[model samples]
Target chain A: MTYCIGMRIDRGLVFMSDTRTSAGVDNFATSKKMFTWCTPGERVVTIMTAGNLATTQAMISLLEERSKSQEERDPSILRQSTMFQVARLVGSTLKEVIADSSPNGQTSDDQFSASVIVGGQIGEGRPTVYLVYPQGNFIEITDDTPFFQIGETKYGKPILVRTYDKEMSFEEAIKLLLVSFDSTVKSNLSVGLPFDLMVYETDSFDTSRQKRIEQDDPVYQSISTGWGDALRDAFQLLPSYSV
Target chain B: MTYCIGMRIDRGLVFMSDTRTSAGVDNFATSKKMFTWCTPGERVVTIMTAGNLATTQAMISLLEERSKSQEERDPSILRQSTMFQVARLVGSTLKEVIADSSPNGQTSDDQFSASVIVGGQIGEGRPTVYLVYPQGNFIEITDDTPFFQIGETKYGKPILVRTYDKEMSFEEAIKLLLVSFDSTVKSNLSVGLPFDLMVYETDSFDTSRQKRIEQDDPVYQSISTGWGDALRDAFQLLPSYSV
Candidate 1:
C-alpha cells in the first residue's frame, strides 16, 4: 500500500508520495514512487503511483525506455504535445502492463492493477493534475476538486478536505501535504517515511524543487509533532455535549 | 454501509452510529443501528451493528424476540450473566443470521456477514466494549484500544486516535465522537446525518441517555461548522515548510 497526493493550486502543482512497499508484514522495503521527466524550458511531467509495485515500475520503465529510444514506433511520454495527451499515454501504458501481468485480461480488481497521478505543465499550457485509473481512464482536477489522492487515502482526507486552499504558496502547500501525510503515516502501517516530494511551479518547466523527506528531517519532525498537539488543542476547544 | 463507534471512558461507555443505509446510490433510507436491553439496577447491554442491513436487522429482531419470551427453550440476551456473555450472544446471533441468509455456510468475506460492537455492564461486572467479528469470535477493548469502530471507519479515525482520553468526561467524549462522525458524514454518502447516540454510566444499569440527533439539530449544526473553522486554524498554526 502507498499514499500519494497530486494537488493543483494557483501557484503550481504539488506532489507527495510515501515510499514504503510491503509484500508481507515481515518483508518491507523502501521504494521511491515519484517519477519525473523534464525537458528544461519546454515541459515538466511528474507522476506518483500506487497499487501493485511491479505494475507501476513496469509502466514507468516502459515510459522511460520509450522516451530514450529514437524509434517512432514507441510513443514517448516526453513527446506528448499537451498534459492531456501525456495522461492518455500514461493510462494506456498502465493498462498494458496490468494486462500483460495477469493471465486473463485485467479486471477492475486485478491484483496487478495500479493507478497514477500525472501532473505538470507542457509548453504554455496551464498547470494541471489528472488521476489516471487502472482502466486507462483519467479525470483532470477542477476548481471544485483541486487535488487528487490515491491509496490509503481515507485517514488523511478529512484534514485535506477542510484545509486545502487553491491560492496557497508552495511552502504552505508542502506544509499542508506533510500534515496530511503525517496523519496517514501515524494511522496506517503501510504508508511510512521517508516521503518523496516534488513542487513544480507553473511555467518554470523545471523539477529542481524535488526533495526526499527522510524520517529524521528536522522540519518534518517539528510539523509532525506540532500538528498532533495542535489537533488535541483544537479538539479541546470544541463545545462539549451535555445531556 | 454504516459507521458506528463504541468507546469506553472512565465515566463509562459512549456510542454513536449513523443511520443512513443504502442499497444503491439512488436507494437510501434511515434505519437505527444501535440497540439496547436493560434490566434496571441489574444489567444493561448495548449493540451497534454494521454490514448487510438484512443480517443486522434479523440478528437484532431475534435478540429482541428471544429476550421477550419467558420460555426456556431459547436463550435470551437479557439473561446473559456478564457483558462478555452478552457479546458472545450477539456474535453468535450475528453469525447465525449470516449463515441462514447464505446458501452455503458463511465465509469471512460473505456478503451476508455483519459485525457488532457490544458494550455495557451486567450485575457487578465492569463496563466494557467488545468488537465481534462475523465469525462469531470477539475481542474485548483494552486500555490500549479503548474504542471500536465498524464500517467506513477510516475517515473518522485519526481524530479519535489523536484526542481520545480514557479519563475524558462523557460530554467531552460525545463531542469528540460527533466531530468524528461529522467528518464521515461530509465525506461519504453511505454514512449521513440523524445520528443515534447512547451514553452509559458505569454501574447505573440504565440506558436512558440515548438520543437521535436529527440533521437539523442545533448543537450538531454548530459543531459541524465550528470544527471546520477550528481545523483550518489548527492547520495555520503548524510550521510552514520551506523549499
Candidate 2:
C-alpha cells in the first residue's frame, strides 16, 4: 500500500508520496513512487502512483523509455502539449501496462491494477491535478475538490479536508501535506517515511523545489512531533460531554 | 456500511455507534446498531454491530427472542455467566444468522457476514470487551488494545489513536468518542448521526447512562464546530516547511 497526495493551491501544486512497498507484511522495501519529467520552461510533469508496485513501475518505465527514444516519442509524456494531454497519455499507458500484466484484460480491481496522480504545468497553462483510475479514466481537480489522494487515503483525509486552504503559500501547503502524511504513517504500517515531495510553482516549469524527506529530516521531525502535541491540545480544549 | 466503537477505559466501557445503514448509496435509512441486555445489580452487556444489516438485525432478534422465552433461555445472552460467555453467545448467534442467510454455510467475507463488539460486566467479573469475528470466534480486548472499531474505521482512527487514555473520565471519553464520530461523519456518507452512546461504569451493573445524540444535539454541535476551529488553529501553529 502507498499514500500519495497531489494538491493544487493558489501558489501552485504540491505533491507528496510514501516510498514503502510490501508484497506481504514480512517482505517490505522502499521504492520511489514519485516520477517527474520536465522540459524546463516548456512543461513540467509529475506523477505519483499507488497499487501494484509492478504495474506502477512498468507504467513509469514505459513512459521513461518512450520519452528517450525518438521512434516512440509520438506517445511520450514529455511530448504532450498540455497537462490534459499528459493525463490522457498516462491513463492509456497505465491501462496498457495493466492489460499486459493480466492474462485477461484488466479489471479495475485486478491485482495488477494501479492508480496515478498526475499534476504540473505546461507552457502558458494553469497548474492542475488529475486522479487517474486503474480503468484508465481520470478526473481533474476542481475548486470544489482541489486535491487528489490515492492509496491508503482514509487515515490522512480528515486533516486535508479540514485544513486545506486554496490560497495557502507553498510552505504552508508543504506543512499541510506533511501533517497529513504523518497522520497516515502513524496509523498505518504500510505507509512510512522517507517521503518524496515536489512543489511546482505555477508557470515555473521547474522541479527544483522537490525534496526527499528522510526519517531524521529536522523539519519533518518537528512537524511530526509538533502535530501530535497540537492535536492533543486541541482535543483537550473541546467541551466535555456530560451524561 | 456503519461505524461503531467499543472502548474500555479505567472508568469502565464506552460505546458509540452510528445509526445510518444503506443497501446502496441512494438507499439509506436509520436503524439502531447498538443493543443492551441487563439484569440490574447483576449484569450488563452491550453489543454494537456492523456489516450486513439483515444479518445483524436477525442476530439481535434471535438473541432478544431467546432471552424472552422461558424454555429457550438456555442459550440466551442475558443468561450468560460472564462477559466472555456473552461474547461467545453473540459470536455464535452472528455466525448462525449469516449461515441462515447464505445458501452456502458462510465465509468470513460473505455478504451476509457481520461483526460484533460486545462488552460489559457480570457478577463479580471485571469489565471487558470482545471483537467477535464473522467466523464465530472472538478476542477479548486487553490493556494494550483497549478499543475496537468496526466498519468504515480508518477515517476516525487517527484521532482515537492519538487521544485515547486509560484513565480518562467518562465525560472526557465521551468527548473523545464524539470527536471520533464527528470525523467519520464528515468524511463518509455511509456513517452518520444520530449516534447512540452507552457508558457503563464497572461493577455498577447499570445501563442508565446511555443517550441518543441527535444530529442537532447542542453539545455535539458545539464539539463539531469547535473541533474544526481547533484543528485550523492547530494547523496554523505548526511550523512552516521551507523549500
Candidate 3:
C-alpha cells in the first residue's frame, strides 16, 4: 500500500508521497516512490507510483537506462520535449513491462499494476499533471479536476475535491496537499512516513522547493496539530441539534 | 453508493448515513440506508448499508420482515439479547438475501457484498460499534480502532482515524463525523446530500438527537464552509519554502 498525491495549482505543481511499502503485515518496509528526472532549466519531470513495487522499480530502471544510453532511444524522457509526450513514453514503457512479465496475458493482481501522477513543465507552456493509469494510458488534470492521486487515494480525496483550485497560490496549494496527505497518514497503516514533497514553480524547470518529512519533523508535527485543533474549533462553531 | 459512519465513544455511540442511492450518475434516487430496530428502553440497534442497491434494499426488507413476523423467527433482531447476536442476525439475513439474489454461488468478487456498521448499547453494557462483513462475521471497535465506516469509506476515513477518541465528547464526535462525511460527499459523486444523523447517549435508549441534513441546511453549510476555510487557514499558517 502507498499514498501519492499530485496537484497542479496556478503557481506550478505540488507532489507528495509516503515511502511505506508492505507485502503483508509482517513484510512491511519503506521505499521512495518519488523519482525525478531533471535537465535543469529545460525539463523537470517527477513521477510518483503506487502498486507493484517490482514493476515500478523496473520502469524506473528503464527510464534511467534510457537516460544513460541516449543511443537506441525511441523518444526517451530526455528526448521528449513535452510533458504530454513524456507521459506517453512512460505509459508505453509500463505497458511493455506488464506484457513481458506476464506472457499468458493473465496479469497478477500484484503484477505490474501501477498508477502514476506525472507532473512538470517542459518548455514555456503551463505546468501540468497527468494521472497515468495502470494500463499505460493517462488523463491530464484540467481546471475542473485539477488534482490526481494514486494509491490509498480515498483517504486524501475529500480534501482535494473540496479545496483544489486552478488559481491557488503555491503556498496555499502545498498546505492543502499536506492536510490531504495528513488525512491519509492518519487513516491508513499501509501508508506511513517519511513523506517526500516537491513544489515546482511554473516555467522554472527545476524543483523550487523539496523536503523530506520524517515522523518527528517539527513542521509536519505543527501542521498536523494545528489542523486537528482548527477542525475541532470549527466543528464546535457549527449548530448542534435543536430537535 | 452510500456513506455511513459509526463511532464508539466513551459517552455513547453516534451513527450517520447519507440516504442517496444511484445506479449511475443519471438514475439518481433516494432510500433510507439508516435502519433502527429499537425496543426503546431495552435496546437500540442501527444498521447502515452500502453497495448493490438491490441487495442492500432486499437485505433490509428481509430484516424488517423478520422483525415483524411471529412464526419464522429463529433469530430476529428484536429477539437478539446481545449486540453480537444482533450482528449475527443481520449478517445471516444478508447472506440469505445474497443467496436468493445471486443465481450463481458466491465467488470471490461475484458475491453480493454489503458492508454494515452496527452500533448500539444493549442493557447495562457499554455502547459498542461493530463492522459486519459480507461473510456474516464482524469485529468490535477497540481503542486502536474506535470507529467503523461502510460504503465510500475512504474519503472520510482520515478524520475519524486521526481525531477520534474514547474520551471525545458527543459534540466533538458529531463535528469530527461531519467533517469526515463532508470529505466523502465532495470526493464521490455517488455519495450525496440529505444526510441522516443519529446520536445516542449511553443510558438513554431514546435517540438523544436525530436530524436530517439537506444540501442547503444552514448547519451543514456552516460545516462545509468552516472546514474549507479552517483548512485554508491552517495551510497558510505552515512555514513556506526558505530555499
Every model's DockQ:
0.79, 0.86, 0.49
User: lDDT score, residue B49, model 1?
Assistant: 92
**Would you list the clashing residue pairs of candidate 1?**
none
Evaluate residue B215 in candidate 3 and report its C-alpha lDDT on the 0 to 100 scale: 91
Query: How closely does chain A match the true chain A in each prediction, as TM-score?
Result: 0.96, 0.95, 0.92
Worst 10 residues of 3 chain A by lDDT: A234-243
Tens digits of lDDT, candidate 2, B1-243? 899999999989999999999999989999999998899999998889999988898898888885466765543777878888888888888888888888977875699888999989999999999999999999999999999999999999999999899999999999999999998899989998999999999989899999999999999999999999999999999899988
Q: Is candidate 1 or candidate 3 better by lDDT?
A: 1
Estimated TM-score for each candidate: 0.96, 0.97, 0.89
Provide the interface RMSD of candidate 3 in angstroms, 1 decimal place.
Answer: 2.7
lDDT of 2 by residue, A1-243 (tens): 999999999888999999999999999999999999899889889999999998898898888885466764543787888889999989999999899999977765699989999998888889999999988889999999999999999999999999999998999999999989998999999998999999998888898998999999998999999988998999899899998
CA lDDT of every candidate: 0.91, 0.91, 0.79
* TM-score between model 2 and native: 0.97
**Per-residue alpha-carbon lDDT of model 1 for A84-169, expressed as tens digits?**
99999999999999999999888978999899999999998999999999999999999999999999999888888988888988
Task: List, in the given order, the native-contact fraction of each candidate.
Answer: 0.71, 0.79, 0.47
Which lDDT tens digits does candidate 1 get at residues B81-115?
87877888888888888988889888877989889
Report the C-alpha lDDT of model 3 over B1-243, residue by residue, as the tens digit.
788988878888888999888867989988878888777898888888887777888887777775556776543667888888888888887777777777776655754677788888889877888888776778888877787788888888766766667897877777788788888887788888888888888979886578887899887788788887776665566664332
Model 1 chain A poorest ten-residue lDDT run: A66-75
In model 2, the runs with Cα more than 4 Å from the true position are A66-75, B66-75
